[model samples]
Each structure stands twice: as C-alpha cells, then as structure tokens.
Target: MTTSRGGDGQSSVEVGTFIKTPSAHIVEILAVAGLDFAVLDAEHAPFDFGTLDAMLIAGKAAGLPLFVRVPDFQPSTLLRSLDLGAAGVLVPHVDTPEDARNVVARCRYKAGVRGYSGGSRSSGYGEKGMLAAVADAESVQIMCQIESIEAVDNTRAIAATQGVDGIFVGRADLALSMGLADSQHPDVLKATERAIAAGVSQGKRIGVVASSLEERKRYSDLGATWFLHGSDQSLLKQAARALVRA
Candidate 1:
C-alpha cells in the first residue's frame, strides 16, 4: 500500500489489527478488509509453524504485509519466521540498546547472523541469487517492542541502534510491569509518551497497540505512525455481543 503524507509532511497513520486465530482464511479476510497490515500474534496465540507458514502464504497471495510477533528474542525463531516470508518481525521485551543490537544482528546476514537460504519464500524460492537474497532479507522491517519501564528509559538508544526499523510500544505489558490494571493509567501514558518522543528524536517510526480509535488518535497525535487495534478474537467477541444486543 502507498503511504500518504499528512498535512505536516509526515507519513499518514497506518492502522492494522492482530491475528490471534490460526487460520489462513482469516488472513485473507483481513487483507480483503483493506487493513494497512496484520500482525500474527505468535507470542500469545497458539500458532504452529505449519499454520504460520500457511497464513503467511495467504497474506502474500492476498497482498497483505504480514508481520510476526515472535515469542521472544530467539535468533532461530526470528530466522525461521523471516524464511517463512513475514514482512517483518516484532521482537518483544527489548529493554536495552544491547538487546536491540543483538536483535538487529540476528535479523541480518551481511554483518549479522541470519542463516543464508535462497530456497526460502523470502528469496523467491531460489530464483534470486545470494546477493539478491541478502538484499531482500535486509529490507525486512525489524520493530522492537518497548514494553517495560526499563525499555522506556532506554528508548532513545534502542531506536538509535543500527538496523532497527521502528519502535512498537506495548502498553498492556507496560501496565502490568508498572503494577497497574489499566493500560490507560496516567503513568503508563506518560511513559508511552516518553518512549514515542525518544523514537521520534531518532527519526524512527513509532507504533503502538491502541484499544480504540480514540486511543489510537491520541497516540497518533503524539507521533505514533502505526497502530494495531483489537485482535481478531476481540473483534469477533465485540460483534457477537453487538448481535446479541441487537
């Protein structure tokens, strides 16, 4: 999808949702629904590698950029997801510049440790040579999730790390870390603002998981360029509740 520029010359905000259900059809549906992107929640959802492979294929077939939220900082997991053809990977719990640097290293090939594989889907199934494959791999986005107070404090350094494409604020986990029940707690908001500002200072794209359109707008005004709204299951539940009410 083409990114439009806002009046202020910044890229227009992109809105996507999480995919919790392990279904390729669901991926197709999200693509047809015209969302900006879809992030498969591998960290919290029950998604087997085979299912993930199918979902990624569906996303590619339907023209949707699919990102995988990996369970952790495992290099093998990151490499496998990239090989499966995800547009990007959202690494969770990156609380320091050191962590960010390690993630970048694992996701790259030239100056990093990602294993070479020309047969992977990302490499056009061996059609692309080694040089082309490495270049394509380097183009994949790497978004580090800033979910803890420590991460918020280290936001600038994390964003400044070479090869980190963006920062995705994880408010729910941040709230839990802060010993709060509400993701919208004032302290959480303050920390999130600080993190966003830090990312912006480094000229990095900022992202957040907002619970509603209003919350999304609030963060957007604070310079978050992308948002992940409710997940597939959450949307289904909401629609079912509405149907019952109707």
Candidate 2:
C-alpha cells in the first residue's frame, strides 16, 4: 500500500487492485506486487460461492488483505463475504446516511446484525474461537460507495456514519448519473471533488478507481487516499492486445 495524503491530510492512503475473476494466480500476483489490498468485484462479476471462497483462502495464504465488493447492501451478502474470511467489504450504491449505517451494521458484529458463526473460515474454522471471531468482525472495514447524485449530496453524512471506515467514489456510476459516458468529464470531476471534500471534512479515507496513472494523480491531488488501479480482466486484455500488435 503506497502511502498518500488522505482526505484528513493527517491520515495516509492505501492502494489496492480490483479483480473480477476468482483466480488464485491473480491473487498471488497482487501479493507479489505488494498492494495493500485487493477487492473481488462480486458486484459485476459472476463469481460462484465456491470460487469466491477459494479466492479468499488464496488471498489469506498470500498474506494479502482481500475485500469483496458485494452486489448490494443486503445483510446476507455482507455476512457471507465476511464468513468466507474477507478482511472488509465494499457496499455499492450507498446513497444516503441510512444506507451507510445499514452497511456498517451488517459488517460489524457489535453494531450490525451479522450472524455469529465460529466455525466459519474467518474464525479459522473454529481455531481462533468465537471470541476471536467476534473481534475480527468488529475490525472488519466497511467502505461505502459514493456514486449517484444522491450519494454525492449526502457524502458528509455518509462519511460521518459511525463504523464506516471509508468512502469509495464510483466514477463510472457517477458519470452515468450525470448523463456522461466519460468519467473524466468536468461534471464528474466536480462531483468527485465535492465528495472528496465532504469525506475529508469528516476525516474519512476517500477512494477512487483510476483509469490511468494520470487519473490517479488527479484524484490524489483532490485528497483521495485509496486508489484502485483497475480490474484484472482489463489489464489482461490490454497486455494481450499489445502482444498481438507487436
């Protein structure tokens, strides 16, 4: 994880990568790259439960903090991901304070309604014991995705929600909300700026997906600390296309 100035200015940044496929090789590569974390894009990817669990196990073996981008804010979805040993969860389409709070509640054992299970993989299959599993649940990070116009409008409240660890700006979705195809448009940039400022005001870590190195620098300048470079499939396709041309 490369350290950058967080929205709070005092806090540091955490860098991560996103993967669509549940591939152990890809998880190992992320570990070798020394990324602070890796997120499995379950929101967009059709990952079967078995594959997802295997990927999480692979990530643990590699000592990489693995997170899951659940398709929705459903408690069961969050619970399943955590039960499988995810270090954290990224909840999509969190448009209001209530949404943010619900996510936190579902993620944390102390605050949320996540079911307790000591025999789960997160508890080392009963090796760590129930007490340790409870502690782990409390420590699980909850990142709320700020994407739509409503979410941008409520950024401050969302960031201030207790148990919410960070805010992730979904640039593509934000662009769609603004009726633009390009996330780099001025309108999207302005919205992201506002979201970042709001998150910073509350001392929350702000994250964004950078389409390129330039975009990463741009978001960093705006006080975004967590940077997700892109997805595994995209990178693989880009490399293959280049090789074909060469």
lDDT of 2: 0.86
Q: How many residue pairs clash in each candidate?
A: 0, 1
Clashes by residue pair, model 2: 105-112
Clashes of 1: 0
lDDT tens digits, residue span 1-246, model 1: 334687979979888999999999999988989998999999999997898999999999999999999998788899999999999999999999999999999999979999988889988899989889998888889999999999999999999999998999999999999999888899999999999999999988899988888888888888898889889999899999999999
C-alpha local distance difference test of each model: 0.92, 0.86
Task: Evaluate model 1: give its lDDT.
Answer: 0.92
Error of 1 at 186 (Å): 0.8
TM-score of each: 0.97, 0.92
**Deviation of model 1 at 244, angstroms:** 0.9
